[model samples]
Every structure is written in structure tokens, then in C-alpha cells.
Target chain A: MKLSRAVVIVSTCCLLAAAARADEAPLEGQVLVLSAASTTDAVDALRAAFVKTHPQVTVDAGFAASSALAQQIAAGAPADVYLSANERWADFLDEKGLVARRRDLLSNRLVVVVADDSKLEVKRPADLEQQGIDHVALADPTSVPAGIYARQALAELGLWQDLEAKVVSAADVRQAMQLVVSGAAEAAIVYASDAATSDRVRVAVELDESLSEPIRYPVVLLNRGAERPAAVAFYDYLLSAEAADVFRRYGFLVMADDHPAADAVPVAAAQRWWGLSRDEWLALRLSFQVGLCAVVASLPVAIAAGYVLARWQSRAKWVLELVVNLPLVLPPVVTGLLLLFVFSPKGPIGGALAGTLGIEIVFTWLGAAIASAVVSFPLMVRAIRLAFQAVDPRLEMVARSLGAGRADAFFSVTLPLARSGVLAGCVLAFARSLGEFGATIMVAGNIVGETQTIPLAIFSAGNRPGFEAEVWRLASISIVLAALALVASEWLERRHATREST
Target chain B: MNRLSFRCAHRFAGGFALDAAFETDAQVTALFGPSGSGKTSILYMIAGLLRPREGAIALGKQIWLDTRRGIDTRPERRRVGFVLQDHLLFPHLSVERNLTYGLRRRRGENSAIEASRVIEVLELGDLLARYPRNLSGGEKQRVALGRSLLSGPQLLLMDEPLAALDAPLKDRVLSYLERVVEEWHVPTIYVSHNASEVRRLAERVIMLERGRVVHSGSADELLLEGYSPSGDWEA
Candidate 1:
């Protein structure tokens, strides 16, 4: 009977050990985390820390304005976890039945900031009303959560009515802080964390928490991520003691009751192809694809415009010239915004196109291509026009007299002669498209793989504190691409010159 | 034989004016004039390259242009071959491609002026693979003439075709022109400021002076009135 009891105890011990083994199975698969722009540094640090312990898991992150991230999630972006700077967007997702679980993750304080060398002293919200503070920058008060908090603080202090006239609205908190850093604004109202990012700007006043609603960041795991074990592990790790410490270091007030921190393990440097990570390679490849599509799509229209501008003699020619060249001189962002208006779902052309053909352009690669095409059009046309202008008009006339139609003459005679210029223009346009950022971000929304090009990737990398290496890498790639394009065009022009002089 | 009639009045932006009129059924008619006398302008209007402010141009029963009637046939539909003063050979095309360009565009089944025949008559066989940029001035003019001939035009307009060549090259190209005209008796209007070029090429001559038709007669009668071998008319 003692032997029987011993066997039974052994079986029990074996069962317990098997269960423990099952619990310790390594988490694998990818976790996509979409976070607020203000949380970029904290999130990057947390991701680095998390990946160290869960070495088999990959955590891909995207950071933008919370509203944009929420919209992306609503539009069916494959985001596993979303960390918004405010509860409103999280609640919006919950109402849409998109959120499976959520909790308040962190909080922040709003502050007034001024340039490091500024003579104006802004100790209180009322100080912003001084004549010395001619301009004050803030994130868009109507939409961005940081700006809304700043607006509430100003209203609570009874300074909103007087200081509203001097306010310059920026797209995001970092941009608002950048204005003060650049001395473009006498002061700016931004998050304390963002203000801490730049040594060029100094925090003048931290608005009392009582002045505005408590600024809470809510983290949510979407329904799409509920079944993914790696996503759940990453989401749970975000609330652990290690992540809380990261948040605290980045000036955020950690609100989660953190669990025990994971073991600190060193992560191996990710494998690189030609000194670029997988994501950076994806961005580089997308840039070339988009640049090529832009050039190919715009070539026929550009050629026609160039031909008309070169040969047509009319009093109204200047009008056509101005319209063709407007994009070259306009702020690329303004050009992007204009394209957004015409290509948005509610727009006339966009609505009709979607209704009839089911073609959605906004936030897609095609939208990116269109933006690049528009931004690079003037350069293409100018080069092509110069090329066409250099061709003798008599050759076309001779073709015409030889029973060739206008189009036939152009294709056979004029276009062939201007081929080098057209090639140069194409290269120039492609290079310009590769560097197109302002319009691409506005229209394409910086979605990874779908629209994030090299320039956009660089912009994102530049915003995050720990990604300086990534920023330099992407910037160097851009320079290399542009240099190669310039070399190709120079070679073409030289060949054309030699052919002509021969 | 089809009769060709032309009348036009045009004013240049620089205030120069052209008012000329003539009708001919000859195989070769020359618009003889000095520089700025609007010889090339008349050829351009006839070929539909330029529109006169007031004009009517016709070849036999075909009304190519009548401004008052609001009818102006496009240059391609007019079926008139034009060889410019610069021998405007398509610089990007080889000699063979240039010669066949117009031949390929001919809408009619009129294969009377075959590409091989034109190539042989113009002696363009050796230069077929060479681009216009690689050809000499005289070679370019011959290729231009061959290209125009292969189009099977109802009429050919020669705008001082040898004007760009030096004297020796001009004589060689003029000989090629005579061979082309002899092989295919296409009705032609040749424009030249040089009296000798006109005398060599024209059966009938229409003299232009200060934008008006000063005289119209046989080439011998008009050119011999006051012409010199140096191509100047005695003032």
C-alpha cells in the first residue's frame, strides 16, 4: 500500500510539470501596435524592452495623431493594439464594437513653452496675453487631444478670449513645440513630454491638472487581436512594471497597476540586408514602386502639356503655363490638401468613381502615386517643354507636308527628337516623387507597407527619439537615390548633346 | 494635266505684306523673287503650312483653301509634298526611314512612285543607313526630295531646296532634282530668289516684287529681261 501511494504521487508530480511546460510555451508571431505621436519615445523604449524578453515575438509600431490612428483602425487597419492619448477615441472604438478590452494606461500635463533664448517670461497662462508674446502655437484645438486640453486650460484661467487671436494652430503637439523651438512663435502650448524633447524650448508653466479634465491615455486591444497570443502578451507587457518605468522616464504619469517586470535580456541586432532592417527595406521598395508608377502615369499628360506650352502661340498661353506650374511653387502640403479635397470620398469625382467602379484612392498606394504625380508634374513638364522647344518647328511642318497627321508627326519626328529631354524629365520626376513627403502624408496617411515611402519613413523616424540611426539610414538612401537619378539624367543630356553635335 | 490656281494676301507681324496671284498647268512653275519678296510665303500658303488673311488655292477641281467660304483643308489632306529650304530631314531617322516615312502614310494605292525607284533615282542607296545628322548638306537635300516624291503628292513645293548648300553641292543636288522631276512628271512649284536656279528648273515663271506678281511668262522671257548669271536683276 505504501508503494501504491508512491506511484500515485509520482503521477501527480508529472501532471503538474506538464502543465507548467504548457504555460511556458514561447510567444511567437507579430504584434502591430498603433500609438499616439506623443508616446513615440515611450512606446519605442517599451517595445525594445518587451522584444528582449519575448525574443521570438516581433512588435511593429506606428505612431501618429490619436485621431488619425483611430480613424485608421476604424477603416480596418490591421492594428493589434491601439494606445490613444485620450479616452474619447477609445470610447469611439468601443461604441463601434472594435475594442475587446481596454484600460487607462497613462496621463500627461500640459505646459507653456518658449524658446531657450526668449526674453519674454510666461509664468502663467495670462502672460501669453502680453505684447511680447506676439504668437502662441498650439495643436489644432478642435481635433487634437493635446490642443483640446490646452484650450480647456486657457478657458479655465479665463485667458482664452484674449489669447485666441494670437494663437497659431499646428497639426500636432511636436509641431506646436517646434514652432517655439524655431522662434516662429513666442510661445506654444504642448504636452510636457513633448516640451521635454527639445532643448531649444523651455517649459515656462505647467498648467494645473484642475484647470482641464485629467488627460488620460487609454490602451485597447482590438477584437482582431484577441485570438493572437503574441498580441495579448505584448498588450499585457505594456502594463507591466518595466513598461511603467519607461513611461515614467518619458514624463508620463503611469496609471496602470503594473505586474512584475520581465527578465532583462539583451536582444540580438536584427538581421539587415545592405544595412537596412526589413521595414526600412519595405519602405525603400515602396518608394521606387510609387515613383515609377507616378512617372509612367503622368508621362502622356506631361508630354501633351509640354508640347502645347512649347509650340502653341496664343494670348491665353500664360494661363495654361501658370496652371501647369502652380504645383512647383505652391507649398507641397497645400498641394496635397487640395488633392485630398478632390479625392476624398465625399468629393464629386471621388464619390462618382467609388459609386460606379468601387475604386477607393484615399489612404491607398494609388493615392500616394497621385500625390507624387501632382507634386512632380511641373518639373516633368518644364523639362519636356524645354526639350520640345529646342526642336525645330520646320521638322513637324515637313512631316505634315509629307502626308503625316499632326499626331503622326509628333510621334515620329518631334517626340523622337525630344526623347532625351523626356527621359531626363522622367528621371527628375521619379526622383522628385521619391522625396515627396508633405503631400504623401496628407493624402496617403503614412500607413506602413500601403503608403509609407522612404521620405515618410524618415519623417516618422526623425520624430521618435531613439530612431536617429534609422533616420540617418533612410536619409542616406534618399540622397543616394536622388544622386543616381541626377547622374542618369546628366548622362542622358550629355548623350543628347553629343548626338546633336555629331 | 491638272491646273493649279493660287491667290493670297497676308501681312506679317513685322509689317511686311504679300499679295500675289497666278495659275499654271506647266510641269514646273517657278515663283521667282529676291529675298523678302515672299516667294517662300506663297509656297507655304499653297502647301497649307500658313494661312493667308484672304486667299483661295485649288489644284484642278480640288479646293484646298477658300477663306471666304470657310474651308481650309489640313496640310496632310492636301496631298502636297513640301521640301523646305533647310532640307528639314527628320534628324532622328536614318535616310531609309526618312524616305519611307511619307510613303507609309499614303492613303491611296498609288504605288507609281515606288520607294525602291526613288531610292535608286536619288542615289540614296549608299546613305540609307545613315542619319540626317551624319549626312552632308547635299545628301540631306536629296533624301528630302526622295521623301517628298515617295508620298505620291498631286503637287510638290520646293522652297529654295538648294539654298543651304554651297555652290558645288548645290549643282550636284540640282542635278538630283532634275532626275527626280524627269522620272516622275509631278506638277511642281519651285521657289527661289536665284535667277539661275529658277532658269534651270522652271518651264513657267511668275515674278514677285514687294509682295505683288510683277510678271508671269515663260522662264526664258522673264529671266532674260534683266537677269545676270550671278542671279541679280538689273535695277
Candidate 2:
């Protein structure tokens, strides 16, 4: 009996030791995770729980629009795991052999949201087209996963064609929600999780699953991190019950082992115009309008500033020059944000204008023009200043001796001599404006047929799956336009030189 | 003819002080001095292009500048024609457009020198359609001279007008200058360091040395007494 008891104790002790070993396997080093912006809060909670059990493991997380993160991964960003808002980006990485393993981690439902104070009755998908719904915001349907899903659901319900005009695209789902909250948009179609985060918006309707492809968040282990034990541990921890509980708390649908199959929804065919789809053409047209308007509106001010910078001799001249060139040296996004502060409805300039003229600028084409103008102003002023400086000051003095007044001499002699530089400045500003995205997106809010310029269109296209052709087309057009502007500017400069030399 | 009386005291940043006074009613009065002797500054002051610290300048009855009275007419209203050393014609305008530039400012007043007469005397008919960038040095100077004449100024100021030209070109341009003085007979202040050019052009000479007037007399007396036989005066 003693031997039998000893044998039992030994076997039980061995089993208990093995169990302890399995639970305490130390995970060391760093695991970098790139996640969708919508899943940031949930991922943070999951990371906290994961580090508690594996104290040696450090979790570093980055969150942005899923499509942008996927692009970054494809460009060889040092990311071990990617949690995409939809399966498309994961599939994109998988097709490129960048994803080592992937699984559907969570599901989310689409909801149409309106301001909490809104009295409009929106019962179904068709209700989006009802009267008083002037503008509907969505994630960029061409590129962003949320917007693609929203576009699919709208197309499935046959309301896309009619409601397309009122749809304004945001860079991401969070931005779409913010659009509704800020009252820049009357309505927004966003993930249920995103809607829950905002108190200003009320969910009007939850879209049925049958209306579009199943909205699934897929967690992926990238090939770069497949060999790292810390990354593998973090990847497994993301799929554990603790992580699922956190996701569920954040209004995400925790996927079961047996989830619904993903159906391949047919993409709607786009109508073509001049070898480009209607939306692409609209973006191109809007880019031209914004570019021309920006150059025309800012030219007089730029010329005057250029003249002062070139000719004025004073201690305060450096300060004027610094102010004029500030936008050039600053990051485009920062410039955009500064412009937003000055041009928002509640902003000083915007408030006075709106109060007196009843004219709003935010989310409008004029806002896009203003953003482009501000960003391109430095380039214009620099070129024009150099041009004016190149003209002989004695020419003006001689004109004065010929009985011409100060203003007369400038108009007749100085302006004619500096015409080439002025023209070159215009072309440069136009090109700069055409490629303006960061600031324009910030102030203008990417409204289709209104503020969606070529760069913005390319950004939207770049974020969508299976829109590679459209992206290439828009990108090529931009390249061609920039090349032509540069060539024309060079030709003008050369002509000016040859004329002076002769 | 209106007599021009000018007296000025000015100090340049380089410590060059100019204190001189003269009066002339001659058709061509020469400001004879070497370069950097404040000759250009005096001519500029007379044209209202430069301001003196204290000065009184009168062309006949009109006061172009008087520091005591605070009467400083603008350069354009002073109607003093200036022929720059470089003949600074508008590079963008055609030769004809450059000649006609000052005509636009002479509205309501009848111009004594007609465009046709100036063009005929300067022989600029062949260069009318050409731009200044295409013109030779002598041609540019002729255009500059004709441009000034057409403005019908009360006085003309020429600052080393032949300084940029070669010796051969200078002789040809000098003949053109002689014709302008003999034909239009405008009261003129001509600046030059070349004594021979002054002898050929000026009735009276104000000799300057280190920014001060050392002598003032007929061109023959000043050039003979102060200048070397080589017709060049050294500062």
C-alpha cells in the first residue's frame, strides 16, 4: 500500500509540474502590432491583459486606417501582427505572401447615424435618400474597408445611384463619425462600434447582413514576425478568450468557431466618361477648379508680397519673408490644421464671414481652394520675388526720369520684365495645388464632386481593395500634369534668359 | 531760356561731403569731374532722384527743391529728362514703344519736341520695331537721347552718356549729342570726366575735385587750365 501510494503521488506530482511549465513559459522581446483605428481601444485592453501573463513581453501598437497600415506592411514596415477592420486588407497581404497566418477574429454591423437632436425618421437603407438629409458621410468607399462595405450595402439596396450625390467620403470610419458629430454632414454610415463611441450621434438603423459582404475583422501574423516567439505568443493571446471578451465589451461581435461563410459580393459597374469613371472624372474636374481658383485668388497678394520682399529695405523685412514662407517649410498636415483653425465656422475669420455673408467655407470647394492657396503661396511668392529681384532697380528710376509715376513705372516696366517669373510661379502653384492632399483633406473634408481632388481621389482609391486600376489611372494623370507644368516653367525661364542674353 | 541755380550740401555714407554752388543758363553746362567725385550725386540731386541734406534748386521761376521752404517736387513733376550712363531703356518694349513711353505722362501740355522730329534727328526709323536687347550700344544711346527729348523737359541731365561706348562709337554718339544741343537747344547739365568731350559739348564747366567745386568758368578756360593734354582729368 505504501508503494502504490508513492507511485500515485509521483505521477500526480509529475503532471502538476508539467502543467506549471506550460503556464509559465516566459515570452521575451517585443511584439509590434498594427491595428485598425476602430480597434485601438480593444487592442489596448488586450495588450494590457497579455503583458500581465507574459511580463517579459513588451507590446507596441500602432493604429491607423486599415488600408494605410496594410500598405505600410507591404512596404516592409516592422510589424509582427496586423488586425484589419475587414478581410480585404488581410487578403491583400495574404495575396502578396506577406501574411503568414490569418483568422477572422471579430464581426461588426453597419449602422446609419444621425445627430441625437435630429427628428428625421430613417427606418431603412432607403431612408438615407429621404428629404432633409442633405449630406451623408461615409468612409472613402473606393479604398477604406468601412466605406467599401457601406457602398456595397447601398448598391445592394438600389439607393447608391440616387444617394451618391449627397455622399461625402472621409479618410476613415472615425472621421465619418466625426463628420456627423460636427454637423458638417447630416448623416454617416459607420460601424456599430464607432457609433457607440459617440454620444452626439444616434444609430438610426442597423444594416442587415444580407445587404453586403460580411463585415469581419481578420487578425494576421505577418511573415516578418512568424519566427519570433514573442510575436507568436502575442498573436495567440489576441485569439484567446480574454481578448475576445475585451472586443465584445467594445461592441465588437466575437466570432465563434463556426462563423458565417464570406460570400463574394459582385462589385457594381461604374459608368465611364472620357476613358475615366464618373467619379474619377469628377475628382479630376474638381482638382482643376480648385487649382485654378487657388492660383487666381492668391496671385495678387503673392505679387504684392513678392515685390515688397524683393525691393523693400527695412529691419522688419525678414519677419514678412518668414511669415510668407512658413507654409512651405511646415508639414502639409500641420498647415492644414492651422488653416482649419482659421476657417472653421467658429473660427475668427470664418465666424465673421458666416455671420455677415451667410457663407460657409468648411467642407466646400472654396475651402479646398483656400487650403491649396495657403500651401502653394510660398512657392508662388518665392518665384515671383526672384523674378522681381532680377529686374534692374535703375530701370524704375529711369522710368521715373521719363516722367512716369511710381505706379506707372511698375506697371509698364517692372511688370513686363518679370512676366516670365510671374508665369512660372503660377504654373508651380497650380501643380502644387493639384497635388495638395493633406491640407485639402483637413479643411475640405473630401466631398465628392465638391472637394475630392486628384490627390484625394488617389488616396481614396489606394485604400480600397481591387481598385488598383483606378489608382494607377489617377496616379498617371497626376504625373503627366506635374510633368507638363514643370516643362512649361522651364521653357518660360529659358525664353526669358535667351531674350535677355540677346 | 531759363537759368538753373543749384546749391547743395550732402554727406554720403562713405564720408564724401559735397558742398558746391553754381548758376548756368547755357544750352549745355558740363559737370566735369573724375569718377567718385560726387559728380553723379550732384546730377541726381538736380534731377530730383537724390535728396540733399540742405539745398535750394530753381529752374527759372519754379522751385524744384528748397529745404527751407519744404518744397520738393516729385521727380516726375520736375520734368527733368535723364540719360543714364547705361542708356537704361525698357528691355521689354520695342524701340518705338520706349521712345513713346514718356509721351503718355506729358498729357495736356504741348510737347515742344515732336516724336517725328526726334526720330528724324536721331535716325531711329530703322530701329523702331526692334527691342532694346537687339540694339547695339550706340543705337541704345541714340534711343535714350530721343526718348528724353520727346518728353519736352524743362532741363536735361546726361550722366556719362558715352561712357559705355568704344572710342569710335563715342565719336559717333558725340556727334549725335552735338546735334541734340544745336537743334533742340534744351537747357542741359552734362556730366563727364573727359575734357575733350566737355570742350566739344559744354558752354560752361564746373570743375570738381573730391566733391568740391575748385573752378567754374568757360569750358576753354577750365579744360585748358585743369586738364592734361591727353584730355583726361585725374581726381
Off by over 4 Å in 2: A1-274
**lDDT value for model 1:** 0.83
Q: How well is each residue in B61-86 modelled by candidate 1, as lDDT tens digits?
A: 99999999999999999888898888
Every model's DockQ, to 2 decimals?
A: 0.52, 0.49
Instruction: Give TM-scores of the second chain, every candidate.
Output: 0.96, 0.97
Q: How well is each residue in A1-502 modelled by candidate 2, as lDDT tens digits? A: 3323533554465456435433644324667788887775678678878889877776766556899778756644457899999998998899999888899999899999998898889888788888889899998899899999999999999999999999998878877876776678889999887766555678899999888899999999998679898999899988987776667667788788453323212232232323898668879977877787788778889999999999997889999999999999899889977877777767888778778986657656778889999999999999899999989998898888888888988888887788888888888999999999989876775544556799887776554323557878899999999999999988877777677643
Model 1: how far is B52 from its true place, Å? 2.2
Whole-model lDDT per candidate: 0.83, 0.83
TM-score of chain A of each: 0.68, 0.52
Q: TM-score for each prediction?
A: 0.78, 0.66
TM-score of chain B as predicted in candidate 2: 0.97
lDDT of 1 by residue, A1-502 (tens): 3323533554455455435433643334667788888887778778888888877776777778888788867754557899998999899899999999998988888999898888887887788888888888988888889889999999999989998999899877776776776678899998877766566677899889999999999999999788799899988988887778777767777775443322222222232324888668879877877887788778889999999999999989999999999999999889977877777766676668678987767666778889999999999999899889989998898899888999989888888888888889988999999999999877777756557899988877655433556877788888998999999988977777778642
User: In model 1, where do residues sit more than 4 Å from their true spots?
Assistant: A1-34, A41-62, A67-83, A88-212, A218-274, B233-235
